[model samples]
Target: MAAPIDLELKKAFSELQVKMIDTQQKVKLADLQIDQLTRVQKHAKLTHTEITTLPDNTRLYEGVGRMFILQSKEEINNQLMDKQKTADEKIKELEQKKVYLERSVKEAEDNIREMLLSRRAQ
Candidate 1:
């Protein structure tokens, strides 16, 4: 009886450890993606600011596939807005996912602690 219980407990611990590791990895990945998106959004905002400060009639060129194409100020502003919007959306989604992953990890840790306490009591 004791041997079987020990084996089961070990198995459970192994599984929980695996789950925690997986969740941690996922959280790290989400953090990295969020960081990248944030940088992109920041860059877009800065570029938009610079563009706004320029003369209205100043010629502007937008980059496309390693080449610059002449574009109007309005078009460039529109593109920057789009970029910011898209980055915001993606960052929001990743943040939500990170929350979920963190919750799962916390739950798994609690479960492991509960299991240990129960085994000790027994």
Candidate 2:
């Protein structure tokens, strides 16, 4: 009977360990996504500037030049905005996961403590 209870406790601890690892991985992925979004935003700004700086006399300049430039800028701005939104959402999710994982770890610790105390009492 004691052996079965010990085995069950060990399985529970093992499962918690796996969940902790998965939570850590999710946090790292979120951090990387945020970094990627920041870089993309910076690149989009630089590209928009380059496109705008083309002189009217330039051979590559096409019909409705100003309109084209504005459209391009708007597109880049929209992409950046989208990336930022995604990053923000990912970060929020990661924070929630971290909180939940922390709580789970704490609970596991409490369980272990209780088990030990019970053993000692016996």
On TM-score, the leading prediction is 1
Candidate 2, residue 60: Cα displacement in angstroms equals: 12
Candidate 1 residue pairs in backbone clash: none
Tens-digit lDDT track of model 1 for 1-122: 67887897899889988988888899899999999999999999999999999999999999889999999999999999999999999999999998998888788779878877887888
For candidate 1, give the lDDT of residue 17. Answer: 84
lDDT string, candidate 2, 44-91, tens digits: 567556755765444432236455433344454466567556756766
Clash count, one per candidate? 0, 0
How far off is residue 59 in model 1, in Å? 1.4
- Candidate maximizing lDDT: 1
Point out the worst 10-residue segment of candidate 1 by lDDT. Answer: 1-10
Prediction 2 global C-alpha lDDT: 0.65
Q: Candidates' lDDT values, in order? A: 0.92, 0.65
